[model samples]
Structure formats: C-alpha cells, structure tokens
Target: MNETISNSPHQWNTQELPVVVIAGYGPSIGESTARQFGSKGYAIACLGRTQNKLLDSVQELKASKITAAAFVTDCGDTRSVKEAIQQVQSHLGRISVIVWNAASYVGSDLVTGNDDPSEILNQIVGVGCAGLLASIQEAYEDLKAMKGTILITGGGLSGYDQNVNQIAVNNSWMGLAFCKSSQRKLAGLLHARLKPDGVMVGTVIISGAVRVGGGLDVTDPDDVATAFWEIHHSRHKQEVHLGSLTQLASEPT
Candidate 1:
C-alpha cells in the first residue's frame, strides 16, 4: 500500500509540527494548500486517486524541505479512506488536521435532461457529502485523541444562490442543507459531546469558483490553505465564508 517512492523524505524537522491530511489533493488547490501548510511547518499527507499526480505533489512539497507523502486513495470508498488514514498516521505520527475537499460532478444540465438526474445527484451527494462523512468518521477518534481540527471545504452553493445548472444537477439546495446540518451537528457532538476529550470540528464555505482575476473572485489556493492553517492553530471552532461575486468587481482581462 506504500505507493510513495522510497527516496521521499517523510520527516519534518520542527518541534511542534502539525500533521495535515488533505483528501482531495488536486494539482491546483492541493499543491498550493500543501505548500502553504508546509511553509508553516506542517507535515502533509497528500491523498488522491492518481498516484502520479500525488507523487508529483509530494515531491514539490518536499522541495520546500517539508515532510510529505503521497497515497492513492478513493474518498468515495470507506475502506479506502480508512486505510489512507492509517497510512497517514503511520507516516506523519498523528493527523492534527483533516481537510475533506473531494467532489464529483458529471457536467449535466438538470434542466436540459442531458443525463440521469438521480445518478448525478447521487454522485455529488455520495462523493461531496458522503465522502466527507467517511473521512471524518475514520479520523474522528484520532482527532479527538490528539485534539485536532477537521476542516471541510465547501462550495458557493453551500451558502449562497448561484449557478442554476449546478443547483439542479447537484441538488445544491438539499446538498447544502445537509452540509450545514452536518456541520452544526458535528460541532455540537465534538464540542459538547466530546468536550471532555477535546476535539474541534469546523467548516470553510468557499464561495464562487476559485480562480484568479475574476469578479466574486474565487479564493486563492494559498489563502484557503492559510485558512486551514488558522483553523488548525486556533483552539475554537467556527464556520467561515470566503468572497462574494456580487460585491466585488471583475478584474480587467
């Protein structure tokens, strides 16, 4: 199960280093997020389905002299997620932060009837919402034992109205409701139910498509990474939203 190259350096030289597990390690956000956390002395465990891409991300993070390991993981599968978390714990010692950023979209217009609406909704809920549940469940005990932070990455629709097509296909209304409910429930359970044990659960609602130079501009991967870092460092847990497309003007192309 060790897909990472042996030459990889999997050790950080910091006394109080934070261990972070990023489930959806995409080239854009994953890499940027890892680098940002690494710069702050956090050992990163980059997990994704693509082995090559995961390795590349690990190498890039290692270039900064940060401890990093790449593991092939499928978030939709609970067994796979559980195994990945175990591997991360073995390599990084203890996971202090868990970021669930995995999502799936088939690009079908719910209004046009281009594809099976039920299937698309199932995939989104399964991967976007259910996958997150699996990740958190698998790592919850460890986070609680270590007093870690669980930060879930969300979309604009999770908090606001936009993208009519996405709304229909992903059932944004129901999906967001589920997300909010889960966040509050998780926070209550962790903070209230597990207060004696000491664990924090939080969510970061990322509004708008994350892009450079755009109105209601998407948040920068680095900024999002910083937010994750902050969540990990802070003792309290809370939900926070990024930018608004309606408030900010688009950058001149």
Candidate 2:
C-alpha cells in the first residue's frame, strides 16, 4: 500500500506522498475526484493541456489544503504524456492512481460528412485511449509497487440501445460515443492484463447526462468520484454504470 500521512498536513513531504494523476483535470469529475483522493492524503497531479485551467484547479485544491500541482501536456501525444508523468514523479512522488478522463470529438457539421473521413476517425480516437496507454506504460513501476488503480470515464453513448445511438446521433456526439466505447474496451483489456500484477483497473460508464451542479443531472461528479474511491479499495468490479443502467437491471455482472 502507498504511504499515508499520519501527521499534520503542514508537516507533509511532497516527495513521500502517493500521487493521483488526473489525465483530463477539469471542473467536473476531475475536480471532485481530486478532492476525494486528496482528502485521503494523496497528492493530486492535475494533468491537462490548458495551463490556465490546470492552474485554477491547482489553486482551488491548494486552498482546500490539498497538496496539488499542475502539469500541462497534450494527452493524445505519447511524448507529452510521458513527459508529464516524469514531471509528476519529480515534483510529487510515485503515482498510486490514475483517472483517465480525457476525450475529443468532431463538430456536428463534420460528422455530417462535410469533412475528411480520416478526421472524423481521428477525432474519435482522441486523447482517451492513447493517453491511457501512455500513462500505464510510464507509471507501471510505481503502480505495481503500490498496487495502484486506474479508473476510466465512459459515457452512455457506449451503452443501452438505439435510444442511446439516437441520442448520440441527434447531438452529433458520434465521435464521443465511439471514443467512450473504445475506452470501455480498453478498460476491460487493462483490467484483465493488470489484474495479475496487482493493479486494479475499472471504468465508470455514465449512461446519461453528467452535470456537476446537480439539478436535472442524471449523473453527479461526486458520485463518480465516490465510485472511483470504492473501486480502489475493493479492487473488484471492472465496470460500473450509472444513470440509464439503473433501468436496465440486466447489466452484465
């Protein structure tokens, strides 16, 4: 198990802290997840392409008395992702967990076939799958040593029925839908591959709208964060579905 701080936060050592690297650090799920883990004594490593956004999240985390820092990098690029991992280790410590939540997509007009076919496919591949692969390779040593976990964010576009497909097409979310499906499969593959090595891997497939502020939101960011934490501790349940899955009842166990 990764070392946890038993003393005051003021006496914490950054290098001795176990890091939780958020691949697509943002205001929603990422922020919630960071807080959830940080409160548990893990140093948060905010990884994203936008420096301003990363800094904002870092400031908020710091304000909450959580040890956090940002690393700006394009998740789709292997070199950039690997470099960020190196930087996180240098600044924080060994990475004990990774929340892979980066995504990309083409515009509605592009999906309507007005642009290059390859572009649509490229957009679908996005930062989700590739970034995850890079992180696993780069952090394998620390993850195995600490029995770390990887939690992926998936969407409803990859589940349910034609209702889901219709919703995806209506909103021009084809690329995102494809990416989520791919991410789910990637999570499954990693779950089986990493299990023997003591590294748990799982995916939270959100089967509806995710609104951080609640209201009419079908999925809550805090819930996702809680699920991640549960998965980390239990080291079981490779896939967890939210929202729409509640009605399905027959979701694979």
Best by lDDT: 2
Cα TM-score of candidate 2: 0.87
Query: On residues 1-253, what C-alpha lDDT tens digit does candidate 1 reach at each position?
Result: 4354424444432454668888888876677778877787788888888887877777777778878877788876677788888777766677778887776644334346466767766665666656666767777778777887777776555433444223433543444444443444554454565456676666666765675433445577767776766776785646666765442223221
Give the C-alpha lDDT of model 1: 0.66
RMSD per model, one decimal: 4.7, 6.2
Q: Candidate 1's error at 240, in angstroms?
A: 1.5
- The parts of candidate 2 lying over 4 Å away from their true place are 1-15, 107-111, 245-253
Best by TM-score: 2
What is each predicted model's overall lDDT from 0 to 1? Answer: 0.66, 0.79
Candidate 2 lDDT, 2-106, residue by residue in tens: 121122343234448888999988999999999999999889888887877777778778889888878887888877888888877866778899999898776
Provide the lowest-lDDT 10-residue window in model 1. 244-253
- Evaluated at residue 40, the lDDT of candidate 2 is 92
